[model samples]
Target chain A: MIEVKNLSKTFTSHVKEPGLKGSIKSLFSRELVTKDALKPVNLNIEQGEIVGLIGANGAGKTTLIKILAGIVHPTAGEAKILGYTPWERANEYRRQMALIMGQKNQVWWDLPALDSFILLKEIYQIPDAQYKYNIEFLAEILMVKDQLKTQVRKLSLGERMKIELMAALLHNPKVIFLDEPTIGLDISAQKAVRGFLRQYQKEFKPMTILTSHYMEDIKELCPRIVIIKSGEFVYDGSLSDVQKMMGDEKVLSVTTQNGVFKVSVPRQDLAKKTHELFEEHYVLDLNIQDPSIEDVIESIMKNGIGAT
Target chain B: MKWWKDVMGMELRKILAYRSDFWITFLGQTFIQLMVARALWQAIFETQGVSEMQGFTLEMMGLYYLIAPIGMKILNGPNFGFLAQEIYDGTFTRYLLYPLSVFQYKTLTYLTYSLFYSLQMIILLGIYRLFISEVAFTSVDVGHLFLGLLLFIIGAIAYCMMGMMIEMIALWADNIWSLAVMLRFFTSFFGGALIPITFLPVWAQNILVWTPFPYLLSLPIRTIMGLSTFQEVTQGALILMLWTLIFMEGVKLVWKKGQFKYTGVGI
Candidate 1:
């Protein structure tokens, strides 16, 4: 459903230092710093598969998603979604795909979610019967049937995010691009979103690509994972592969009296490890051997990775 | 036909949802436009009583002044919106990524607000014409008025497209509001919203006459107020059509290029 070959996006940013002199100098002679938000990246996704993009803060997850969704053009390389070039963004290509961002809302703030949905239904040119049916099914599954009439600003974050999902799914898109779709919500809200997405994917079997820092979100939605650091992709495989490879380490802290702690590593295990020795016997130690996805990310960032 | 129905129906629902804001903006727009029109009419009389320039008797002059500005509220009202802010805030990406054209989205939204605002302004203009417009068109040729309204709508669309073209610059610039203000200032002054073009220095009017800004608001008023002969009106509409075509072409080019520049930072 989607193919991206060596796609890359670079942004030119102006760097101005603070201080009166620096500001004055910039006014006359501005300096630019080219930032590679996304290095040359490649990927492909088949129908009914969920792919997760994981990375550090400056990683290129959002940039890659934007390029694939046809919101931002890449500096180089080729990308096609649903057999049409994404950057060209033909109407046919747009109709089959939906992009959802959890942090930012697509629903109108002051108006009820129903109003935005009505507007989108016409814009998408959905037939009346199909539109009504889709909204009804989505509203029921997402538990937002009553909240549709409430003003968007009045809803809780979880409520608003559910409505956003409903808006994105109203047209029954065949491919979905989700960026941090479960961010800033309680665990229950996050679980609800994940459940709805899983059901949507199962029913429609659309090619789904998701990006999220929350490891649990990825584990819940996507079986395969792609990890990028500092713009270049470093890892791509199943979720278990990541935990076995880069994250083959465990966190062990023994809470003792007076908050004193010690590591429970056998003398035979690798002796070399960065162990944080607290003044108290609570020696917090870090080692390399099977860790969670979060710890792996921290290790990758900490270890000054050369390049991919 | 289906496309038009979908576009208009969507717009209607949006207006209904924001009914309160619609009434507030309409009332404010009518009061402000009328006040400006009244002041201009008084100034014209104070300077040259019963001036015949542009076929205005003192009464026709006052009514012309009144109609032109109220006509302005109808034409340019839809032209102002948050196209630029949406781009800067990354909210516009949702629309772009959807199965819709930016042209269709903007044009539909503009039509909705235009329908709501124009209805109110037309009613207010009717009441004002009854009491304050010293002389009215005795016949009130509905066909001419309809044609004038049609031209006005075309002009509004073209003008709003031009605004979108300028707003597209927000993809690159951090702050685009100043550029928007500058665009508005020139369009308002050159478009004859403040005063009739006939009173301007001949050379100044001659320079602006060729520009599209005048067609945006003034040409429709001219068509209805009978400021031009049939031959001149036909020629002017042709020029307006040319401007609209050029603006439409510009919108396509700018929007296509502007998408490349959008960072999608927030989205």
Candidate 2:
């Protein structure tokens, strides 16, 4: 289980001036600027639930994940994963959780991926039989069993990412924080990751919070979605609810003799509007469809979530 | 204990994997430096018409240069620049997420490096004994040798702590390469890796005697050469231990504050 309340982070940086005179002046009178990466937010994730966290760049998605991962201390509020404060970085808390930053590697570059797993095995103090069983099971599920002996640097991006997942999951963490776990991979690799993650959720039922730029990943893996805007959560509900909240209007595409005409109308008024259109013109084809989740998220991002 | 052993083993494997760098740095560079140093000392002794300089015989000076590299290698271990680079690049997040302490992990990595360098030094020494007729530690004092080994271990740890503290400044500065170079220069000059501390002016020697740099490499070399009295060895050991404690405490404070300042940007 994961719980976050009023969790926020602000970064302060020095405002340095250019040129020698400005540099000299800054020594005595430097300006400091603060940027809020996360506004106060609250959330609760139940065990085995895969929560997709979506936001544009600088939307505090990664910041929130880092705080919960205990890699970055929050500026305000508290986050508890399995009842332990993350920032305390208690060993027991660490042992029960795993954080994977897709852009960065957790495996050793020069050594075989298996070597890194063995090192993790020791670090977590896992029993030999359990460790062996977990590695074999994870590798088989991820279809990276043979590639485990290859030097990590020599593996393809997809292969390396699979090994990274294995390395993180070797101890069978109770909670997993994944930040863009499929960021740079190709399509098949992305699908493979999503498949493995979905299966992992089904089998182990660990609480997982994932942030990814890929919309399809969210659509495929996350049944529940949390949409954040400008460091605050704008929407938190089922994926379908996001589509509905984007608006009750469904797009209507009518293929007339002249051309295809698209118009948006409220779902409740769709039948009447289509009937009137049919009366006024010759309709070759008519299609009514709700907006995609991607469209809903894009709308929320462009024109604050409240407008949706 | 298993974790520590595993960490050290992992580091050793990493070091061994980079065979080219290991051979070039440990064998090539050290061999060239030793040969050049021996030639320079040979020229000075042959031309000066003096048997000894600053209480060092030509043979002793030759042996000092030979052993000084090994001593400096042990004292400095590997540069902590990688630690600084890790902080700057955000790769350190890996350690942050792990259950193990980063300090202990890094210390073990450096210890493995030092151990590997010690092995290389032993091989070099064996080669020297095989090919050359010259005897290095002719007047071996077992008690002093034991004391010197203990001091050497403490001094190596003190240097590691010092390097880590310096590298932690990378959390604030973008380029710590210049700072690291400055540290190396200061340590090599005062630690007598460049020249015997006795060759310096008496006041300079007195000033350095109170600092930790000399104890890092110079005192250990002197103790092994049977040049230090029992009282001086005891005093140096205590001072080295004190310096180790101070640097370790500084590391804790600096690392704690540095983590707060960490932006985790590079990755």
Candidate 3:
């Protein structure tokens, strides 16, 4: 179990003006500004639960993950993961947790991924049988067994990400933090990664927190999600609860000779809107459906929970 | 211990990956330094119309030039910007998550490169002794040679610690390349890699002896050449050890403070 109370982080940066003249002037007198990356927030996650964190850019999703992963220190409050404080970074705590960042690689670029795996095995002190089993299993499931011997830098991005996932999961961690794990992959690669993660989570049941821009990943894997905006959590509940918050609104999408068009209407007006769309144009197809999770969440992001 | 061995093996593989680049840079730098020193010293000797200056004969000066570059290479080890560069690029976030000390891992990598450089120095010395037999320093005392090798290893470790101390400043500064370049320039100039300390004035030499610079390269070379007594060698070891401890403490303190300041951005 992981528990956080009033966890917050603030960052201080220098405010510098542009040009060489400002650079020389600021050397003598500088201005510093503080930005709150994470406001005081409370959260609790149970074992075997995967929580999807949704936010726009600079919305503090990464900061929250970094704090829990022990990569960044918190400015206030406390957190305990499996009875250990993360920032203390005890070996016992670190050994049972894994952090995988898509934009950063833990494996050495110049050497083959297998060499890095062997080094990690030593670092984590994994038993021989367990290490061998994990190597074969993760490689086979991720479908990069052949690429393991190639230098990591030479492999394609998708292949490299699979190898990185293998490296992070070599020890079978109990808590996993994934930050944009499928950020830059193609559709097929993304599906493969999502399939691998879903299967792994089913077998291991590790408490997982995933942050991604892909709504498909969230919809497929996460039953529960927490929405953050401006360094604060605005909503935390099951996906269905968020959808229900739309409150009697339905979507009417019509495909005509021109193109497909979608509009949101109240439940009472769904029939009239569908009839009006069919009469207005040569409708190839028309349907009344629930608002998509993406549209609903996008609305919530642009306009706060009060608007919902 | 097994972890260290495995990581060191990885470090060795990285160093060997670009074999041609490594050799060209290492051998090319050594050759250029030796040629420049020889040209300058020959001109000075010819202009003075003497076989000796500052208690060093022309042959002895040539030997000094030959051994100084190799000795300095061993002490300086490989480049020292790994930490700073990683920090700047936010690649250092992995080290924070790993179940290992960043300092220990970096030290192992640094020592691995130093060991490779030591091997090169040994091969070069062997070739010098076999091909050029008329040099006065050829018949070196075995005991002094062993002591010098020990001092070289300690000095290399100390230099690694010092480099890390400078790199830890990356938490606050945007670019630490200039600091690293300045360190290299000072090490080479004051550590007697460019000119022998014996050529310097007495007061300057005395002042440098108290600093860690001379002990890093000049003292070890002097000890290996059988110019320093056993007592002086022991004193140099003690001073180097003390400096190493000081640098180690500084690194620890800076790392502790820097962790809070590290944002791990850009990833």
- Report chain A TM-scores, every model: 0.87, 0.86, 0.91
Per-residue alpha-carbon lDDT of candidate 3 for residues A142-213, written as tens digits (9 for 90 to 100) = 999999999999999999999999999999999999999999999999999999999999999999999999
What is the overall TM-score of model 1 with all chains considered together? 0.89
RMSD (CA, Å), candidate 3 to true, equals 2.5
Q: Reference contacts recovered by each candidate, as fractions? A: 0.66, 0.68, 0.71
Which 10-residue window in model 1 chain A sums to the lowest lDDT? A270-279
Q: What ranges in model 3 sit over 4 Å off? A: A19-25, A253-262, A271-288, B132-136, B139-142
lDDT of 1 at A238: 84
Per-residue lDDT for A48-95 in model 1, tens only? 999999888878888888888888889999988889988788989888
Report clash pairs, candidate 3.
none
Top candidate when judged by DockQ against the true structure: 3
Q: Alpha-carbon error at A273 in model 3, in Å?
A: 6.3
What's the true lDDT of residue B181 in model 1? 81
lDDT of 2 by residue, A23-60 (tens): 99987998999999999999999988989999998898
Candidate ordering by DockQ (highest first) = 3, 2, 1
What Cα-based lDDT does every candidate model obtain?
0.74, 0.85, 0.87
